[model samples]
Target: MTTSTQIDTERTDILEMLAKHRHFLRLTVRDLTDEQAGLRTTVSELCLGGLIKHVAAVESNWAGFIVNGPEEAPDFSSMTEEQIAQWGDAFKMLPGETLAGVLAEYEQVAARTDELVRTLPDLSVSQPLPEAPWFEPGGRWTARRTLMHIMTETAQHSGHADIIRESLDGAKSMG
Candidate 1:
C-alpha cells in the first residue's frame, strides 16, 4: 500500500480501538447512581467515577502534548499541604461533583481527542515527554505512540473500573 493509504488505515484502526475501549469503560458506569459511581468498592481507592475522570484527564493531557508539546510541569516542592491533598483526590469526584457532570466532561474530552486523532498531519511526528516522576526525562514520543499509550491507559483503567463496578453491585462489564 501507498504511504498515504497506510496512514489512513492506521488512523482508522487506532480510532476504532479507542472508541471500543471507551465504550467498555462507559459501560462500567452506565445506569449507576452518583453515590454508586463514586463508591470505593475495592481495597484500592479507585472508583468508577474516579476512573472516568482520570482517563479523561490523561487523554486530554496526552492529546495536548501531541498538539502543543509538553505543558508546564507542576512544582511539587512548592505545593502546600492542601494542594498535595487535592492532588491525591484529583481522580475522585469531590463534594458537589456529580456523576452526570463527570460523564459529560469525559464525552467532551473524547470527542476532542477523536478530532485530534483524525486531523493530525502525521502520526510519526514526535514530541518531548512531559516532566513527571513516572516519565523519564528527555524522553520523546511520536503521535502514534501517544495514541497507543492513551488506548492502553484507557483499557487498563477500564479493567479497574469494571472490577470496581462488579464489586459495587455485581454488574460485570463483560462475561
Candidate 2:
C-alpha cells in the first residue's frame, strides 16, 4: 500500500499477516541487551537475535526469488562440516552482532518485501524451485504462494523466539 494503486484484499491480508507475526517475533526480544539476545536458553542453539536475523534473511532471499527466480542454492546434502557450521551460524548472533543491528536489518528487509507485495504486477507469476534434496524437483511457486511461505516461516520462528524469551526470563510475547 505504498502507492496510489489500489491493492486487492488478498495483498492487504498478506501484509497484515506478515506484520502481525513480525511483531510477536520482535516483541520476544523487547528489553533485551545484546548479550541477552545472544544467549541460548534452550538446548537448541536458537537465540533471540538469531531468530530475527534468520527471519530477515529468509524474507530477503524469498523476495529476491519473487523478483529474479531462484539463485544458486548451496549443496546442503553434501556440505562439509565447516560449511555446515557456517550455515549454522545463520542462527547465531556472532561476536559483535547486536540486537538493534539485526532488528534494523529486519525492518529494511520487511519494507522491501511489503513494497514487492504492493507493486508486483502479478501475484500468480511463478518461479521454479532450486534443485535441492528437500524441495520437490521441478516444483514451482507462485508469488502468492511464496508470500504465504514467508508468512508461515515468520510465524514458526516467532513461536521459537517466544520460547527462547520465556526460557530467558519467563517473558511471554503473547501473554
Candidate 3:
C-alpha cells in the first residue's frame, strides 16, 4: 500500500473508534431528563451530564494543543471564592444548566475535534504537556498520541456512563 493510503487508513480507523465511543456515551444520556442526567447513580460523583461536559472540555483543550502549545494556566490568585468553587465543580452541571445545552456543546466540541484530525498538517506534530500534577513535567505528545488519549478517555467514560445509566433507569447503552 502507498504511504498516503496507509496514512488515510490509520486516520479513518482513529476517527471511527473515537466516534464509536462517543456514540456509546451519548446513548447513555438519551431520553434522560435534566434531573436524571445530573443524578449521581454510583458512589462516585460522576454523572451523565458531568461526564459529557468533562469529556468535551478535555477534547477541546487537547485539540487546541495540536495547533497551539500548552496554554497558560489559569491565574487562581485573582479568582473569587465563587469562581474557585465553580472551577472545582467544572465537571458537574450547575443550577440552570440543562442536559440539552451540555449535549449541544459536546457536539460542537466533537465537530471541532474531527476537523482538527482531518486537517492537521501531520499527526507527528508534538507539543509540551500542560502544567498539571497528573502530567509528567516537560512531557511532550504527538497529535496522534493526543487523539488516542481522547479516544481512551471517551471509551473509559462511556463504560462508566453506561453503568450510571443502567442504575438511573435500568437502561443500558448496549446489551
Candidate 4:
C-alpha cells in the first residue's frame, strides 16, 4: 500500500475511536433535562453538561495547539487562586447554562476536530507542552499523540459519566 493510504487508514481509525467515545458520553446524557444535566450525581464536581463543555474545550485547545503551538495556553504552574478556581469551575455547569447549548458546542468542536484530522498536512507535527506542574519540564507532543490524549480523556470521562448516570437515575451505559 502507498504511504498516503496508510496515513488515511490511521486517520480513519483515530476518527472512529474518538467518535465512539463521544457517542458514549453523549448517550449518557440522553433525555436528561437541563437541571438533571447540571446535577452533581457524585461527590465529583463534574456534571453531564459540564463534561460536554470540558471535553469540547480540551479538544479545541489541543487542536489549536497542533497548529499554533502553546503560545495561547496559560501557564498552569503559575496560576493565581482565581485562575485555579476558574479551572475547577470548568467541571460544573454554571447558572444559565443548558444541556442543549453545551451539546451544540460539543458538536461544533467535534466537527472542527474531525475536519482537522482529515486535512492536517502531517500528523507528526510537534508542539512543546505548556508549562504545567503535571508535565515533564520540556516535553513535546506530536499531533498524533495529542489526539491520543484527547481520546483517552474522553473515554475516561465517559466512564465517569456512566457512573454518574447510573447513580442519578439507575441507567447504565453498557449494562
Error of 3 at 89 (Å): 2.5
Q: How does model 2 score by TM-score?
A: 0.91
Better of 1 and 3 by lDDT: 1
Superposed Cα deviation of residue 67, candidate 1 (Å): 1.1
Q: Kindly list the per-residue Cα lDDT of model 4 for residues 66-169, writing each as its tens digit.
A: 88999756667788999998877778889999898999999999999999999999999999999887889899999999999989999999998999899999
Report lDDT per candidate.
0.88, 0.91, 0.87, 0.90
lDDT of 2 at 90: 83
lDDT of 3 by residue, 1-175 (tens): 3498888888899889989999999999999899998899888988999999988878888888878878733445577999887766756877899999999999999999998888887889999887777779899999999999999999999999999999998999999
Estimated TM-score for each candidate: 0.91, 0.91, 0.89, 0.95
In model 4, which regions exceed 4 Å deviation? none
Can you list the residue pairs that collide in candidate 3? none
lDDT of candidate 3 vs native? 0.87
**Poorest 10 consecutive residues by lDDT, candidate 1:** 69-78
Question: How many pairs in model 1 have backbone atoms within 3 A of each other, for residues 3 or more apart or on separate chains, i.e. clashes?
Answer: 0
Report the C-alpha lDDT of model 1 over 1-175, residue by residue, as the tens digit: 3588888899999999999999999999989999988889877878888889989888888888898887633456578999888766867878898999998999999999999989999888989887668879899999999999999999999999888988889899999
Higher-TM-score candidate of 2 and 4: 4
Per-candidate Cα RMSD to the true structure, in Å, reads: 1.9, 3.2, 2.5, 1.4
